[model samples]
Target: ILIGEKRFRQQSEDPRTSPSHQPEAGITPSPSPRPRSPDDLEEGEVEEVCEICTPPSDVLVVEGQVVEPFSTDHAQRLIGQIMVLNAQIDRMQEQIDSMRYRLDSMQQEMKNMIDVLGRI
Candidate 1:
C-alpha cells in the first residue's frame, strides 16, 4: 500500500519538487554521504513498505473506493453489543446448570420415595 502511494506520489511529483531533490530535514547536506532517492529503492523494499502500510479489515466498496463498511463508532457499538450478548449467554448457561442440578436432586428424592413405598 505504501509502495503504491509512494509510487503514485513519485509519479505525480515534478522532478524538481521531489523530497529527494530537496535538502535533508533539520540537517545540512553532507558532501560524503548522499541522500537516498526514491529511484534507489529495491523491489523488496517496496514490498516491505506495502506489508507495513496495509491494515487488517474486511474490504467494502463504497462508491468507487474500497473502504470499511462501518464507521469506527458503529464498530465500537457493535463490539459493546457483542460483549453484552456474551455476558447474557454466560448468565443463561449458569441458570441452565443450576436448574439441571435442582432437577437431578428432585429426581433422586422421588426415587427415594418410590423405593420406600416399594419396601413398605
Candidate 2:
C-alpha cells in the first residue's frame, strides 16, 4: 500500500481509531516478540560500509584484526590493565578502612579526656 493513503482503522472494527497495524510503507514488519541480536539491526556487516566495499573510518585493521574503535577498545582491553585497576581499588578500600579506624580511636580518646576533666 502507498504511504499517506489515509486509511482510518480501529481497535476492533470502528473507523475512528487506528489499531496500529504497521506502517503503510514497505518497512518489512519485524516479527512479533522476536528476540533480536545486536547485529541484526545493522545486519552484522562488522564495519560500517560507505560504498559496496568501502569501510568507514571508525574501525581499524591492526595485525590482521578488524577492531571497532568505540565498541572494541574499552570493552576488550587487556586483562593486565584490569588487574592493575582492581588492585588500586583494593588499596583505596584499605586506606579508607584505616582512616575509619583512626577516626574511631581519636573519638574515643576525646571522650576519655572529657570524662577525666569532669572528674577533676
Candidate 3:
C-alpha cells in the first residue's frame, strides 16, 4: 500500500483521542499528522513499475548510487529526522533572538556613553 494510505489505516485503527496516545513528560507530540509525499518514499518500498510508468529519465541517483524504493519504516525514520532538525532549528532561532536583544541593549548603552562624552 502507498505510505499515505498505510498511515490513514493506522490512524483510523488507533485514534489519538485515547489516553494511551497522550504525550509523556519532556516529549512533545506532533500537532497533526501529515500526508507523506512521493519524495518521502525510501529505497526499499518501491514496487516494480512498468517501463512506461518509470522511464530512464525518472530514475533517482544520489552520490553516484541509484536509489531504489524503500518501505514505510524508512519513511518513518526520515520523518523523525525531520522533526529533530525542526526542533534544533527552533532552539537556534531562540538563541539568535536572545543575542539580538543583548546586542541592541549594548548598542543603546554605547549611544548613551557617547552622548555623555559629548556633553562633557
Clashes of each: 1, 0, 10
Tens-place lDDT digits, model 2, residues 35-82: 344556564434322222222321244687675666555755766689
Highest lDDT scorer: 3
Q: Lowest-lDDT window of 10 residues in candidate 3?
A: 3-12
Pick out the ten consecutive residues of candidate 2 with the lowest summed lDDT: 49-58
Q: What lDDT tens digits, residue by residue, belong to model 1 across residues 53-116?
A: 2112212346877767788899899999999999999999999999999999999999999999
**Residue-by-residue lDDT tens digits, candidate 3, 7-120:** 112222445446554334433222334445556767666643212222232234667667778989899999999999999999999999999999999999999999999999
Clashing pairs in 2: none
Candidate whose TM-score is highest: 3
TM-score of each: 0.43, 0.38, 0.44
Candidate 1 — which residues are off by over 4 angstroms?
Answer: 1-69
Instruction: Give stretches of model 2 more than 4 Å off.
Output: 1-76
What lDDT does each candidate get?
Answer: 0.58, 0.54, 0.60
